[model samples]
Target: MGETSKRKRKRNVSLTPEDITKVFEKSMERASADIAKLIEAITGGDAMTRLGVELEGMGLDRMQVIRVAKYFGNKPNQLHIHIWNGLNDSYKPDFVKAILEE
Candidate 1:
């Protein structure tokens, strides 16, 4: 194993500026799509502006968004669990569905 590790060869390939630009563009596109999906699921039938307004004061990061969705069911509910068990790892839409069902 040590001999094989020492014999490892390096492959050299240089990416041109255009190649870098294309890679960056693809990554940005994917990231944008994912963010859009997350936001869409979180907002659902509600207007994006509403979410923007609520998130304004709260600074709803990913975990906070999950927590709010989990406890609140994307609508007001009376079930108040004050503990953060980190069980709200489900994505926004699933969390909303689970909470509503519960």
Candidate 2:
């Protein structure tokens, strides 16, 4: 019997921080200002599930899907990361800066 090896498939897609930010923003776009505020109101609830359900419904690409999954796994922490990409420049200083302070 001849030995044979199968090569593992690798994704050609390489997502830069910029690309991640773009995808996260795209996923966020599916959310409205009302929803964002609503998330704030329900802090201890299943915010990640809510966000993930919303992002999952948005039909994000594979990378974005994975990103959202990871973020959802750690809801409150990743909330900053998600909001950093999702929110406007004005709000970025708050959310993005929070991520750094941790």
Candidate 3:
């Protein structure tokens, strides 16, 4: 028998601050003029469940997902290394848009 080994996959997708900002803006596109509604809409909503299967695939717990939302909603200026390192590009916009949706 021959010995074989599987390689570990690494996501090397590095997002610049601008890229993060772009994604954030896209997620909040549905926000209207009302600040309260905008915050409510973005931070907590049915959007999280929108990613159904993708949630399990990404291994993101509920709080982490909420944190992602809050991070985008409130602190778009900061570099959120945790979510950035944990999720790749694919799991990003979809997750954010899920909550951002009306």
Which candidate comes out best when scored by TM-score? 1
24-66 per-residue lDDT for model 3 (tens digits):
8876764543666765455443333443444445677787666
Which residue pairs show collisions in model 1? none
User: Clashes per prediction?
Assistant: 0, 0, 2
Question: Which parts of model 2 have CA positions greater than 4 angstroms off?
Answer: 1-44, 72-102
Q: Write candidate 2's Cα lDDT for 1-102 as tens digits.
A: 333332223335677999999989887887776687776565534545555555555566666656645644566545444553466656634442344345
Off by over 4 Å in 1: 1-10, 45-102
CA lDDT of each candidate? 0.52, 0.56, 0.55
lDDT per residue (tens digit) for residues 1-102 in model 1 = 586665664335789999999999999999999999886555453443443444434555676555555554444322222122233533444544454455
lDDT of 2: 0.56
Superior by lDDT: candidate 1 or candidate 2: 2
Instruction: Please rank every candidate by TM-score, starting with the best.
Output: 1, 2, 3
The lDDT, on a scale of 0 to 1, for candidate 3 is 0.55
Error of 1 at 26 (Å): 0.2
